[model samples]
Target chain A: MSEQYVEEGDRRREIIEAALRVFSERGFGGATIKEIAREAGIRSPALIYWYFKDKRALFQEVLGAKVPVVRAVADLARVMDLPPEEALTKLGRAYFAFERMDARVLRLVIGEAIRRPEVAEAFVRAGPGRVLEFLKRYLERQIELGRLRPHDVRSGARMFVGMLIPQLAGKLFFPAMVEDGLTDEEHLRNAVETFLRGLAPES
Target chain B: MSEQYVEEGDRRREIIEAALRVFSERGFGGATIKEIAREAGIRSPALIYWYFKDKRALFQEVLGAKVPVVRAVADLARVMDLPPEEALTKLGRAYFAFERMDARVLRLVIGEAIRRPEVAEAFVRAGPGRVLEFLKRYLERQIELGRLRPHDVRSGARMFVGMLIPQLAGKLFFPAMVEDGLTDEEHLRNAVETFLRGLAPES
Candidate 1:
């Protein structure tokens, strides 16, 4: 890439980081471009519009960028050929790790989504929606390979994703209830095991 | 019960309903007793204290009362003797029904739980904590009856609850992602079937 192009990309990344901080502190409705510009240390607040169209656009970019799992979901081809156990285990670990790392952003997205229909749509489109779609395709491939029993791959996708939701919810929204003797790894292993056994093909 | 005592109970219920509305609009930190009193049609804001100790108490009550599944979890005795398929199906239906009926309050508790640690603790203690504990006991009893395979009942309980989380989350946080061919009944059946098959006893 040319020097000027690289510099513009770096500047965009910086602005997104600043916007995430601002959005985390104040929700989507409360965050303003001026504050984001100040947070990014940009002298001209109007410069934000040079990169993004509006606050909604910036918010959408932030939602898509902050979640590391979105990138993982996009790169499913790397693990697509592995057995379901290994592939799912890797996915589960990455899923929980993202929850731990970007919990503040996750909370912000969830809280805003509840109040704003537009934000909710954007969040689902950017995050869980993509993850579920990836899983559905992965399950279909596994079934084709005779690794999984024939069933509704879509429901199977949701069920696998659902098996991981409680741990995330407990860790984020209810810390008191999480110390129920099992570590995250143990819990995840159980989830994957049950899912595989439940979908095992006939002998 | 005496007539006057019954009246006091009814008045307390009225106050809780009013508080739920206010809390749904504003959150835990944002809600105030005065506004709640106005919403409740109570002449004196101080009268709220007579039914509950303070705003925190009222908020807790609102969280507890708004979730119909909490009541269902407590009434598990009514379904304990049935097979796992029947009992778990009943539990899962009630769980989704509560999410539908009280999505607003669920959002309120979740949003506030992110902002306030106290609210988070109270929410888990009153809601998911009780539900998980009830499920754990029920699973343990099932194992004793030779119906389910002997395994870690605690993890089993969490796995069952986890299986239902995605649907609740999709309905509340992201409405667009839920209409994936299967109905709620179909999804819940998939979950229960997977869980029971995974935990089925050795022949």
Candidate 2:
């Protein structure tokens, strides 16, 4: 019975992965269950229903799956031993790396989130609000340690995230913006360095 | 003949404004010429053709109209008398204020730019490339004047503009993100100050 359950779980994941690609290419309104099923190599759309209750349910599942990445970054802030600057740099690198790997996912999320309040609310709950709270606490600790300037930690965190996104999103939606021969890895590392320099404490 | 030409110009402007609203609300593929005509107070769809060759032509005009704002900001860097920091601050404030006043127009430009290379190319030519070039020169001057840290000026400019966009775009697409009770002017001023602080020379 356990083996059967594991196999079913894998099948569900496969379906969700196919759905994400279709949904990203053609938005929620533009995509169809038939197309998603075809992409999944399933003969009947009914199989998707067996895995997910409906199209909305499947989309919510795909969105919820992104929570782990945001959570991982937030959890990194609590390690307590690393220097504040080092911790921030590590977090920034990890965040940018994730963005590079999943640029399409982020674009689809942002695009759909604009049209769907429910998606935006889910994203805020899972990602931005939680990440903001984590960063705020981290900055407060650094401020207490006299390691950083006094400012609104929330605003600072928001600015930090904001700085990374335009270039990251630009590469995803406008690959032409990136000059030839530069890999996404190179661009992201460069972006993280620039961001950290701006955020670094004055000597 | 001149009276007839003036009337024709008025009708063209009406069509463009209507296209802006429709495109902003419904997106490029979703918006129809018929709805645009109705919104423009035209009795027949054929009247749209009298002004614009077609729907695509009208869309192109709307995108092109944004060029003036970009040109004005670029001209700021050419004003040799203003100090670098002061000029950058003013340019940032001007860009943000224009976005606030014309959020719908900006959204239409950005949204369509994502889907159309021509729109994106026009934007790069008119805005980002110009802004970055202007900023690169400004930062180079600041470094030479010993006002900023020695760094790649292009990197500095990209960071500055990247940081500003999220909140500017958020103000349009996510008003809830803004603090309650802050007037638009106050919010913009505060944003400018925060950005300026981020750009301060390292001690």
Candidate 3:
């Protein structure tokens, strides 16, 4: 009986992995539960239903498990000891790459947001909300340590992250907007330098 | 007759205005040529075809004629005589309002961008592209006059605008993301404050 329970747990995890692959390929609207089940090699529709009440619930689970807002928090913590300029540059690059890699999932949330407000609100809370809060905490720490200039920590955090997104989103949505010579590294580096200069403590 | 030519011009202008209203309400995918004709008070579909090849061309024309990147350029000129703090504050608020009011038109352009690259490029050029270039010129002028600190004018323009977008877009897509007591005025005011302080010239 215990062995059967373990097998069921493995089956559930496999279904989630397969669902993510299907969703990424076909998008949430185009993907179906039976296709997800077939992708997972689970012949029984009942088994998939037993695991997730519906496709929406399964999609939400996949977003939470696969998308990595938490990875940003973890990555920032690793670089906390560096000076503000270096730490923020590293964090900004990580944030940029994170959003770039996860653009499809973000687009899914955005499309759903157009149809219903609840899904958008949930995504903000689960995704950008977490990253914003984490950056605020880091800024507050820097201010407390006198390593960074003091300002409205919340506004500062928002501005810092906001500086990184326009070019990032532009590149994703309008690939042609990126000039011939500019690169992601150069863009993030310039934004970080300008931001840090702007944030410099009053002389 | 000359009267017939004059009437044709008047009808074309009227059709463009009505199409703008219809497109804003229904988006590109949802707006139909028949409905546009109805909105424009024209019974003949051939009239719209005379002025536009299809809905896409009509949509592009409306975007170009109605959405005003030049408005931002013109607004900045009106505010140039003011002190840095006041000018930036007013300019930020105006930009904030511009994007807020034109959100629907911008969304239509973004939706089309997914299927074709040309539309996105045009938008970037007509919309944010023009605004960013205008800003870069203003910042360069300030730097030369020593009114603002010298920085990479491109980066400066980007950071300044980046500081303004989160709240504008949040109010559209995720109303709940906005915090209590952060009114539009307050949001713009706070962002302007943070941005200017970051750009303050060393005394």
- Top candidate when judged by DockQ against the true structure: 1
Residue ranges of candidate 1 with Cα displaced over 4 Å: A1-9, A32-65, A99-101, B1-9, B31-64, B99-101
Candidate 1, chain B, TM-score (2 decimals): 0.86
Candidate 3 residue-wise lDDT at A41: 80
Top candidate on TM-score is: 1
State the weakest 10-residue window (summed lDDT) of model 2 chain A: A175-184
Q: Between 2 and 3, whose lDDT is larger?
A: 3
lDDT tens digits by residue: candidate 1, A89-182: 8888877776443788778778788768888887777788888999999999999999999988867888888877777677766777777866
Residue pair clashes in candidate 2: none
Candidate 2's TM-score reads: 0.68
Could you give the DockQ of candidate 3? Answer: 0.48
Q: Interface RMSD for every prediction, one decimal?
A: 1.3, 4.0, 2.5
What TM-score does candidate 1 get on C-alpha atoms? 0.87
Candidate 3 structure quality by residue, lDDT tens digits, B1-203: 34245587788888888888887787666678899999987778777898899877776667556655445455666755667677667666666664543666666556565444676676566566666776778787777778777777767777777776666667766665566335667766667766666666767
Two-chain complex of model 2, DockQ on C-alpha atoms against the true structure: 0.28
Model 1 CA lDDT for position A109: 74
TM-score, model 2, chain B versus true chain B: 0.59
